[model samples]
Target: MTDSRIAAESWETLRARHSAKWRRYPADVIPMHVAEMDYPVAAPIRAALGELVASSDMGYLGPMPEIAPAFTAFAESRWGWTPDTSNARLAPDVGVATVEFLRAHNVSRVIVTSPVYAGFWHWLEELGIDIVDVPLTSDFRLDISGIEREFANGVGHLLLCNPHNPLGRVFGRDELLALAEAADRHNAVVIADEIHAPLTYPGSDFVPYLSLGPAAERTGVLVTSTSKSWNLAGLKAAFILGHGDRGTELLKPLPEAMHWRSSILGAFSMSVAYRDGVEWLDSTLDTLAVARDHLASELKRLLPSAHLEMVPEAGYLAWVDVSGLNLGDRPWDRILEEARVSVVPGTELGPQYTQHIRINFATSPELITRALTQIAAL
Candidate 1:
């Protein structure tokens, strides 16, 4: 879990969701939406890219041996987990890795918690899997018993997000271990998308499920990436670390003709980001903490009638209750157009949460302040 009081910005995300209005706003008018950031990419990352560009080395690419240990170091430093490099395989993106894993396993049923990331299902449609949506308990933790029931007929997979998207809820060791236990019972794989792991509140703990003692061996936990915390989604590189030879099996069975796999640039970027960008990431986390708090406090003051989830842990997503605003079935759009701010709607995440608007708070302080004022007026 990230410290809520430290940083204040969800920039890249803000820009993406609010781009249309951002284009229309005056030079100073802030469009508080989207997940893209206003901050320049980290200096070290920029320098590394510059060095690569100077060499004019962009061309056809292949695997690099430097990625695993670098990421391993990051895991050890941040989460106290030592990833078994042998169990890891590279994937282009977390979402792709997830849906592909589901399909590869011949899975026809899925389980997920809502209000979740909007793109969670982008990879599942073609497979025609039975989608099982479960609302979180009032406390926002996944209901283990409920999940077990959903798996009564056998849930082939569970898409689990830590430092979860939209809600920003960071589960503790016990919380994640419970899910691992359930997955073990059903012999289902738990695809853990920990892309947001690196940005937790300072001093807060993040536990990778596999490290939760012995139950993980049969759990088939797959950690997607550390890119989100580093803001490298565009890099499209994630890793699958599976124990007991599962990762080897998955790679061997990798769709024979699938060539749009990990990219050279993506691998290079991840290696550099994980190995040398620690300080830069620390500062980014600080920025997000401040921005999320401001966004939360502002929403409370402006939309007092709305029920905002008090985020206990997680990323920069501010899930605000917008159902009371009288925008039936389209509250996210209603707020987007009316408030001139774009946000990931809860409806996209799941049907149970139609009234919530997930705001990306990782942006410039000024834009967040402006977006809040607009929402207040709306």
Candidate 2:
């Protein structure tokens, strides 16, 4: 209820904004679809960008030596692990970093756990890489045996999402170690998209893939950004970190332009965010925690049959199974039409998830209540 660092703007104010989340829907619809947050940017990141523009330093990105050290410090403080900053390389975003890394490694086929981030499918399809979908377990945990089976079948690449997007399940260290061992045994590469790692809740442990020791270092590649955690996607910058020499060798095939193509503003903003934005980040997490719980409670009270199987362990997304609502196969579409609240169709995340929907609950509890109330009325 404190509005100091994490307050979302008024509906009128958010409606005036030009972002896709606001613009994609008409005034009649409440958009609970996009992953972007409604909160203001952290003060440190805003000040840094303001200073850059005031100084007219709008030139192309140059040496961002600060990035490595800032990221190292943040990683150490948050996760008790220090990455090999020497192998940290910049890209325009996580999508570009993932695509470029897979392309550089000549990866023709990759294993993806579903229902996962929709972008994972798009990124792989763009490269014409064969996708092997190994769905998560019934409880939405990693299907390790299924993944191992795929690896044994000669799938040499795995695209992982930790603090996973739609479901918000943070992969534990034990699970990651098992995965690392499997990848090592099969000489497979694991590219982890850990963009949401920093948003993990207090009780859940988010293990960075590269922090799993020798096997992970040998077979793991990490792609992350300040975009998801700090809400800086528009700034357009992300980094890939490798474990050591082997990690470095794995990334060697990426083109030099990958570094320069990044926005200078994005690069420095990320550095500032990592180094100085922890206070704001923590406050925002607290706010999101409340919002997440509010969404769950409202769902239970207003729509008792809707299933939020797991109270999300990280991020603002809530994946609900609405099959019990009996709204038919494409419930998201029906909800949009009847409730006038737009949410992500679960089928987009994976083919088999037709009766589910993903809601963005990073706003006020009032807004969450309103959205759910409207759905309940339906």
Candidate 3:
């Protein structure tokens, strides 16, 4: 593969590409792959979460210690939209929080924009809810008219993904407002997954679903966690934000303990991350920004036949147009066997995305180089 400017750059960029190489490698084989990064934890996060774990303090924790503040602080500091911390509640994960919210709302049939995280269906099935699939257009965005058709048939809930995964398309405010209007029309509660909001590209704006306007009070939105930005996925802590009476009413179906799974260290980490993580997050995002550029350049250099798709301003994950590659049944498996790289397949997300691949570019420079080299050879 052609060389790029990974060196003579930021530590985040250098570390990301290098770490992946070492992590999935034999002594000699490099790994410019995987979503996991090679960089060490930010000092504040390392210090805060480390202090508790070092003390062997693992136990059940209470609700997120000002998770709303942690998140809203990021929002206000970055997006200028102030999310009320008071509405924040805790859940083990975003997917869990979503289904739990739906359960409470007595929603048996939920509608989701297709080719999402893919696991949304797993969660829906686990919760025994039927799904309404609204596939995105060829452009990887909502087929708004199709959604309305589904709404006409009836939808009890709507799941929204801001800065949607794989494709990294951050919905515009007007787009979100239109979605909210549809859910409202169907009498469906809107459950949004804004987990990747923090990593939003530099210029793209993230529009919160519930924060839409007066009509949003009746809409149920669940914003949670800093896992994507801070690289804290294993921490298993996330918060759900709801509005007014509508928020409270959605919880009538579940027992109180369903909301009690928030772990102590996770909550502590969320607080510490929010309170002292501004610089680290900025730096980490800076690293991700580098990864994005690296991936873009490498894609052009190596896989010009592939559709790089629309990579919104933010995010390290890429939605590649592997359709031109034409690998069938299991493109991810094919890439792994041919290239020895593990990537998330689009098939899991939906049939429309079968030839697509979602690559996590959060690794080290060497790893990125090597991963691209392998793909170029393929």
Query: Highest lDDT among the candidates is held by which one?
Result: 2
Tens digits of lDDT, candidate 2, 49-89: 99999999989999999888999999999999989878788
In lDDT terms, how accurate is model 3?
Answer: 0.70
lDDT of 3 at 28: 38
Q: Give a tens-digit lDDT track for model 1, residues 228-258.
A: 7666666667777676565466555555323
Of 1 and 3, which scores higher on lDDT?
1
lDDT of each: 0.71, 0.92, 0.70
Q: How many Å off is the CA of 106 in candidate 1?
A: 1.7
TM-score of every candidate relative to the true structure: 0.89, 0.98, 0.88
| Candidate topping TM-score | 2
**Which portions of model 2 show Cα errors greater than 4 Å?**
1-5
Looking at candidate 3, what is the lDDT of residue 261?
76
